[model samples]
Target: MHQVIASPQGDKFIIARPGTRKGMQIPRAMHHELSSAVANGRDVPGWLVNAGREAWGLELSGQPARGNVLVRPVTPLNYSRATWEINKGCNFNCEHCYLAERAFEGLPRDEKDRLLSMLRDAGVLWLQFTGGEPTIDRDFPHSYRQAFILGMLVEILTNGSRLHRPEIIELLSAMPPHKVTVSLYGASPESFDSLTRKPGAFKLLTKGLKAAKEANVPLELALIVTKHNAHEVQAMREIADEYATTYTEYANISPTYDGNPQPLAAQAPGFLDKSSVFKGCPAGHTFFHVDPHGFATMCKVGRENPIGLMTEGLDGLLRLPAIADAQMLRSGGCSGCQLSATCRVCRPLAKAYQEAKAPLNTYCQHDNGDETA
Candidate 1:
């Protein structure tokens, strides 16, 4: 319930409000002083009070830092960011969804509490709750509130179908998220409903979007361009502009996370943007992903050697970095490939394409007869 969070993000000390994008980097001395004041149940230092007021317009003049500002403790774990799939149960059936199956199931409430605590103990400062659609999850409100209570900045990735619900709007208004990223299927009701294979889907999404906008909830729109809705891209951008919300267009569709090629059929021709050259990433080393059941993976695209958080707890994560390294090895069909240096796909993603037996031209430069490394 603290108004702001003060935490160590890697080597940097930052003070950030939960709902706002603005954050201030403070000196280590200032962080320590604030921590001391909060621990001792003393008033917030005058400088922080002034800084909060100036940076976020917060009125924390004489408030106890203990209740006004949460000082997140540095943990043994080095992770600073994570994404959790609250549940894979989405209300819409998008053809290009990456999950092979949309199972509407997750850990019970008690286990979810344990998992969130473990995430907090693991040093996760920024947590994104995604799903097949996170808004519809029965425990979403509780889990979202719990994450806030645990002093983690929370974001949500949704389809914007349920944002209009009174309880949801109320929960979000009361405890604002760092962001709510909604995926826009199409601009028109006919196109959107047809693409999602759900009648009236567009009406629900627009309703949710308007409600969220009116609530002043932070929002970002992802315009998902596929074969069914590729023609509506301009209109979708107009919608985003209408709301004055930040937007990004995603046209490159990939196979399901489990290597099913069904989603590839939805890829819009001439709209599949070429990915940039594969560079190294800090998946398990810095940030990781979690499934609804608390199984931690290196990232969403690479699901190998998942560590069961429900069983092994935080110690299970110790194995992730090594596992991530092994998964990144250029083995299998990619072994001895000279073009890997300039290849657009990473090892795990390449492995997925290989598993799906997809056409080489979709992911490999070698398929185009380019031998340069």
Candidate 2:
């Protein structure tokens, strides 16, 4: 049996293992369903624990789950605004690399199709086509085109180095994503190459950003905050400040398990808070991540292959039992904490926190399962 904790504010249900983490972890639908059932005098004999069990459907280790490992699934809202890392590997090297592992490599075509279908079905509103460099994918054109054709908004996040390549530019020029996200590593050659490490990467990135502007396509800029360029945030913004589609992303340097950029920093402590309230990291529901190998996951972090191959189209993915279950698990990061307003949780870090069975690193500010407040 599980312990069900309800929020005093209203119908928010916090279902978790007796020893698991705390805070709101119930899906909005389930909470409403249960609340309505109670209000209507329906003989709902089962409590949230029952619903929790129904969703996970996993035979527990028989040992009680540690309270740190809470379960809060995704809801309709999260899936709608999910950020997808369609591609993993990158062309440029950043000092604070997060997605530099082997898994970042492109997935097989069939697998790619399945992942896209799932995202479409799950009602993912914005699809961010990213990678070591999303442009590196030989079939990126097809992938970008497919998302456009499906009515799912799409964006391509890249270093912009290859944007000038004839074939690459021709394709990007012809069919641009809803928005093109590029990193302004530096304002000049020194600052740029210092972070990217590549000799001419900084110039290429600038040229690419300009190219996107000239193409009349939308643009978004992502930066990894670090000692190298924290002071230059304002300067960097000046260059593409208008295109900062992301509300404001400032991530501390956290190294990827592998393939990270040079001059990596120690994982910092503290959680990047979010203003948005979510049942969980909207992986399976609000968003789906497809790796280069064709495997799909609810969250982009970790190698945990929750749902298998994408057998059906977008609709099919939405109906996936495991994905649904995961989405409902809980938002392990942004509930009831002081950081709730600005705390931006990282899925990969959250998953790593869960997998490593360690404390939240101060660098990424993840929960190490040990909470002070």
Off by over 4 Å in 2: 1-87, 103-125, 242-247, 255-280, 310-348, 351-373
Candidate 2 matches the true fold with a TM-score of 0.59
Indicate the residue-level lDDT of 77 in model 1.
Answer: 86
Measured against the true structure, the TM-scores of the candidates, in listed sequence, are: 0.96, 0.59
Which residue runs of candidate 1 sit more than 4 Å off their true CA positions?
365-373
Question: Model 1: what TM-score?
Answer: 0.96
Tens digit per residue, CA lDDT, model 2, 1-373 = 2233232112344442221222345556655664554455454334444545565453433323332122233334235434545566666666666664634555567666666665554545467776767787777877776665444556677777876667666665554455676766646677778777788887787767666566665667766555566556667767767544452455444445332423345322332332343334534644566556545565555445344444433444444436546444325543344643333444444444433333344323334433621
Cα displacement (angstroms), candidate 2, residue 13, comes to: 29
- Tens digit per residue, CA lDDT, model 1, 246-359: 999888777888898888888777775666887988999999999999999999999999999999989999999999999999887888877777777778888887888877
Candidate models: Cα lDDT each: 0.88, 0.52
